[model samples]
Target: MNRKTLVLPAVVGLLAPVLAACGGSDSGSSGGDAIVVGTTDTFTQLKTRPAPLDPAYAYDVGTWNVLRQTVQTLMAYPKGDGAPQPDAAQSCGFTDSGNERYACTLRKDLKFSDGTPVTADDVKFSMERALTIKDPEGVFALLSTIDTIETKGDRQVIFHLKTADATFPFKLSTPVAGILNPKDYEKDKLREGFSIDASGPYTLKAEVKDKSMVKAVFTKNPNYKGLLDVKNDKVELESFPSADAMGEALSKGDIDVMARAMTPDQIDKLSAKTNGDINLVEMPGLEIRYLGFNTEADSVKNKAVRQAMAQVINRGQLVSEVYGTQAEPLYSMVAATVTGHSNAFLNKYGDPSVSKAKTRLTEAGITTPVKLTMHYTTDHYGAATKKEFEVLQKQLNASGLFDVSIKGYRWQEDDYKTKEQKGQFDVYGMGWFPDFPDADNYISPFLDKDNTLNTPYVSNKIRNQLLPQSRREADRLSAAKDLTEIQDIVAEDVPLLPLWQGKQYIAARDDITGSEWAINSSSTLQLWELGRGVKG
Candidate 1:
């Protein structure tokens, strides 16, 4: 459980509008060595771990980002861009009726690494199996908007949609939508298998449990043909136990690059020590830190109670002292880089005002000395979290109006997210990195009644139908306008409070290049494009 959202120092200016990118990576020069990448994702039990490295359960973005390189999809992204373009498919489109229809034509020369030809059945099986899984990590959830999956001839896949959603293709470009082999689970039961059954750039070599994970050399499929959004033929990943630990490793020249978070102290040290051969690259992150109030809790159920509590929150003090000055103030439910973000809450509430908060509480006929519990994840967000919430406790308690208790989880485990998503605690903090680069990513997860994020949120008009409708619109820019309206409603409702956004900090050895992050609203990193220079 964490309370504040992480905002970046650089993206306060770039969070608006859209930028079109060519859908795939341009070819880059190849090198002799495997590029070791570092990250702090050791805890989350990859639901799809060691399972053919398929996309059926690539629910977590970090997990999916890894799978994307190992498994090729029907289409890939444009160079330096985020939108999709055809690759394996000659072209795909909906039926003129616009309902009960979608079709795709497969590339002429395409085969899985196993030499099995890529066909329409593969696509159909990949999707149908997901829908059959009752709950498939989130693949089904993405395509749940779909009504039916059908195939025409040996090369065409038909998707019958439940609604005229324009974002389906964008959703398809996701790794969760990656195609898989039918024979792996051809028996109808999704039994686990560790063999390579993909048509990707690289194949899995080994998975080290909880400590490190490494991918073998990537090789172009001699007969392999599929869409790609990257330039490199083969890539490798070496995972570290934690970001802080990874930073130490990168500095020791143990790894080629660092592609994850860093301790605030490590970042400060890296910023000052240029001659040490480490490069510290900073970018706006899609993850935000925020405190969610369990609106269903009697003490917090009332709008006045929630509002009163929010007003006394001293965001500025917390960022400076606890975050090591690595944060900024946030006023929107969505982060700065996300589309449709607005400072509606700032406009309405101004700053932390104990007097005003107390007045509201009194006027509502409620007393202070309220008891509250806040949940946080100890491992995922780093050491700054405990202090972050402690700062929150100090602010709320000093108002002479509330009593606060804090709880913690060990990253994705502690099942803290489930509790927070289920709306179990009085108040909890979470750091959300977007699933994709749309503003809908912010509003959709938190506001969707089905998403379990409405935990502290009761079913409301805007969240129920309006947000979904916005997501259905094909035009993301237009959808952004609708999502902004939903943001205002959420901020006014106080279902969740906006806190701060995070910046991505990577501490890489100077020889590594192309670790540049996508300015995506989701802040996705294209690890496939990174390479190592000859050892200097």
Candidate 2:
């Protein structure tokens, strides 16, 4: 996904000592600098390596964090702003009027980390592999508009489209479009042997532990010829079992940076220090935490019951009292930063009145004591999730309109065994970080017939008609008109309720320079950017 402009200059926040001398010094002069970054996010491990190391076979942000640094795509997000720029390509842009045909010229003398030449055939092979393999979590669906790929010379590659898609440029900048070495991977099989031929800033330094890579090391890629100035000699990424463990590591100086899954209380405690120790990079976030309703469930089948539940939930209290300033109450599934977003729930529900909720239930012939069972993951999201869901239970039960029963599940086992709940639950919690910044990514994934929600939501207009029409429109703002209607439809139907939009926070040790530019559009950290700060 493309992102908004970044504001992480060398400004001294809580961590004054690290960034205090960043005004005039050359960034690359210092050598042999290294840093350790801790992450609490869950990773999908395959065959001992980070599952996402292969661009054609991986998904999830944890994998994205590693891939974004190790793999180079045709285009990439610039550090200052999340705008797209040529990465392996000398230049790339749309070549035709129908908003379909896109072309790129590969950079001359480009080579993999192993010194093998990068050619147009490699690019074609990578794209073809991703499309043919059809990894369920892969980027195949995102590139559905591509009709054909044609290579002209050794340097030029052209993509013909079946429909007009202005967002195709943004698509190329994603990890899915990462060019691969054809010699290492086959057309339909995922690459094995823990071997990698990197084309980006850093290369994996060791063979990852088989079937589990909770910790890994990386070094600068000597073969890299890209835009980023590599400031650090090495980077070590360590994953923890919980946010508290990660936070404690940062406090004890065991880790130089803490990336994702730091709780709100952890952030507050770090922010409270007057000493110049911890610096928190407040990243612009589009991640949404929402509640999905299973309309097939007898308890919530009625539209009135769903609408009443939406009306009674207090968003402001959820954000302020539970998440602190780290989150904002969301009114639409499409976040505030995106075009075509509106406060549809706010316009319909107003400020969470119990009396209004009661009236809504009464109209649907529901009694005062409506029964509901809510399910959420126990450890996957963060430590604060239990508290957040507890608050939600209290708010609903306080109205005297519901008898809510809450259930917890481990994330890995929850989806596979969902048939126990008859393919639906009364309500369930889920979090979404964008794959691409387009509003379509937010809606299309959740509401389609075989949606991730597992609900039998069959919206023919949204799936078969409206979304297809919007995708064909060349202008994004103009296409938003169709998307706006989709949001309104979703709000009225009330299958999902927008709970909150998160703010990305990275708590790093004060002595880490270039930490300001670590986070990319994918909300994943770039470890290559971290270096030891100049000491006073």
Candidate 3:
């Protein structure tokens, strides 16, 4: 696939029990109580609180899970509407035939919480500053392509892109392109931290370290010129360390929501009692979890060997047994929701027979006993993940073709990517969450050689023409046509193998209404925007 199409800028944590459901609430009001959505993470910092929190630097889905209401973009998806609608900007679109020139005019009365003007210069500053920041991760690297930006006056700003970037406008619609106060970001030198200065309806009202975190109160910023689709009176986010803690808190009526991925026993216990205390809504997620074969791994380097390893496991059984039908078998690189998903690998190998594995290994003339370590972040997904890996080890070892070993690391601890990058494992389980709604978000990050996940992934063909060619295309949907082909090629080469397509599931208290999220959140818990039966 056009690997770049799937560029995931958000941290993209797996499933978090959200206060929201698949369809986000249009008029955000949960039943009687003050909407106090619960989350499982605490942030390291919020130094430059976003005026309209920008998603370019750090777009934690968990955080947005709470912060979305307080923050908005130039455009937004009002539930059931696939395309974006106006929010902050009075009107915004492309004026030039070539799609190189874009313009947005403010609603005139817009101001930040601090009562500063949300002018064209502020918008320019946000984009430029995000680019200048040291996000070596290149999450904001897309801004590098901008040719020039100028304010067409006080209320109107025009963007003349370097190329005909059709998606540039849509890019602006994302949180990354949200407007920010030049003063806050400027003083911080565009550095990321915890004291947020948001212009959204809510703000980070309070804070504590990791133990027990609380959010103050949310008040409408007078300068807020309506832009985002969500409308909520007030809300607060509460943080818990583990699911157990979240459940205990929920039972005590201390918190209002929990995102999915509970222990099978936890789901069973919660499911059995018909207290109407929780609601679980499942929707097709914009994420996929896969087994990445570090090309640098000698065992994985051999095409035949990689093919044999890929053919041994039954993805269907893994999904059914491991995820308990919570997830779907993902044979394609891009998730199903992504526009152009193709079963290229499945078409080539077909149903994964033991005979096929042996045949592939036999044909390869592989004499060396192939052995490799599989790695995964322990804290992120759930208990099933470990079981999934163990089952994998059993399946591969049973084939008599591989001496598989399993290793695990706590994601909360620092070894998350470091140990994996050190090549301590031949294969590791990883997931991709979309940065935006486009299919391009799926392919870009993992396949790009310089990206975090691609450390062991090196394919010149996919990297060069196929990838760069797709990226140059201004039409994202059309670009998916190219990306679909690339995903198939990458599958054939076995640098990374698709495993499962996840469905987003968040558990919330029944009375707590008006919480829903159909979008992909890369995983940060934000606590502002929620209201308990309160709306302005």
Candidate 4:
């Protein structure tokens, strides 16, 4: 059940490319008892009320970030790079061959922050409650494969899957699988409070508000019985309205570290200014930005047209001209750092070629000046998004195969609007931050019949068959071949075009130690790894 030695090392090995510059020193040192971390307004709420400490009801990055610190899961990603070892559970694995049945034995003497014992029954309640509530965007869909759950006495729990699933462990490692204090939460509702009743490395002390920002204060949790070495006595997370504001605060010594939501421009400026003022930790990226085609739209229905667009679009140009080294051109839906990643699009289309694009249109019997409209949320993605799309429009238009017009939408509408509402735009921009570190997470969410992309893409070979088969293989490396094939299918179908993979960066005061080690593949920071420096 303890597959840490074998499973994690393999996962880390596959991710070694991304972690190349991730290892090394702390950001200097300012001997202080408290550290203030500034980020975007992504961490404003503690919970949305009846289901207190329920991971199923919270889905945003902010909520997940806080929940990850307060609640323990069956398995968890370690400080640096390793497999998800046992956290709340002493050991866990499948009991049967099809990878259909899962079992976990609880760690002895587990307790919630309120002093209640965390037992197998609580684990069962936590998972089953998430499914029962069935919050459409919540963790329930992620756990939909679980057909039944059973608790054997006080220490053991079993999960009966509706079908074979190999990536179940990765699910167990997510915030969705975070265990709850059964006494503090109802089985079916959102819980409202600033209360900290769960068990993790930190305990919530208070929530403070300043203008548009919210600051969450935390102290080390005495009830936490995990393997992590908690380095700081107090951790304060300050949320801001904009990345620009956050950057200014970091420069003015208003905060100790800034983690998320800084623009590439901001990163460049901060990197250039790296001295005693601040230090930047460049972490590997699992995040991807891409172009999604609404195949249902009349303009993009022709496969040749899509292929032509692919041929003319220049990823290298986008990375250099727009994103700099903060991002790299991506040819596969699966990121380069993950196992089973293949550069299918690059192999098929090569570099940008106007002649190739024109030939594809002529072969398909499509007319000249195809007239394509691209859509992107002007407010959702960072400041670089508009420039990125504008550059794309120029590239496609310059090829003379088609006429491209660009449109913009607010973040709320762009995200929530159905294909019918946004029909005016044939091709649109999209981005994804992983729910887990697996390649399957990248493909399954966009290619399956009921895909998250909101575009109509029903691949029987992929959704109804291949992906399910891939999920049944317990060995991830063995499953890599199936995933690679899935990526090829995506390239051929062209529902979504892979654009670029991001580079994670953290800017912290020069005196902070442990800052370099905080960013991980989950795209979440390990606050416990950070400590105060020698000079405040």
Q: Report RMSD (Å) for each prediction in the order shown.
A: 6.0, 4.7, 6.4, 4.8
Best by TM-score: 2
Q: TM-score for every candidate vs. truth?
A: 0.84, 0.88, 0.82, 0.87
Over 1-536, each residue of candidate 1 has an lDDT whose tens digit, in order, gives 10112332222444322111111122234555666776665423434333424456445556565666566666666533455667667787666454346677888766777888888888878777766763423445666678888788778887888766665666677765667767665524443433346776666655554523443334544555655444445555565656667777776777766665567777777656535455565644567888777777886888887888768887778788776556777888677665567787777788889989889889988877787787888766676788788888888999998888888886544556556655677777877676655666666566564453546475467755776677566555666667767777776678788788766655556555454442234546566556555322
lDDT of 3 by residue, 137-228 (tens): 34565454477788977788888876566556556655656677666666235444344564665555656554223453454455566744
| Weakest lDDT window of 10 consecutive positions for candidate 1 | 17-26
For candidate 3, the 10 contiguous residues with the lowest summed lDDT are 1-10
Instruction: Pull out the clashing pairs in model 2.
Output: 48-210, 48-211
Task: Estimate every model's Cα lDDT from 0 to 1.
Answer: 0.63, 0.74, 0.61, 0.74
Per residue, candidate 2 scores C-alpha lDDT tens digits across 128-204 of 88888766553566666788999988899999988777777778877778888888778888775344565888887
Please report how far candidate 2 places residue 150 from its true position, in Å. 1.9
Looking at model 4, which ten-residue stretch has the lowest summed lDDT?
A: 1-10
lDDT of 4 by residue, 192-217 (tens): 55565677888886554421126778
> Model 2, stretches more than 4 Å misplaced?
1-30, 44-53, 191-196, 205-210, 366-368, 413-426, 448-455, 473-475
Ranking by TM-score: 2, 4, 1, 3
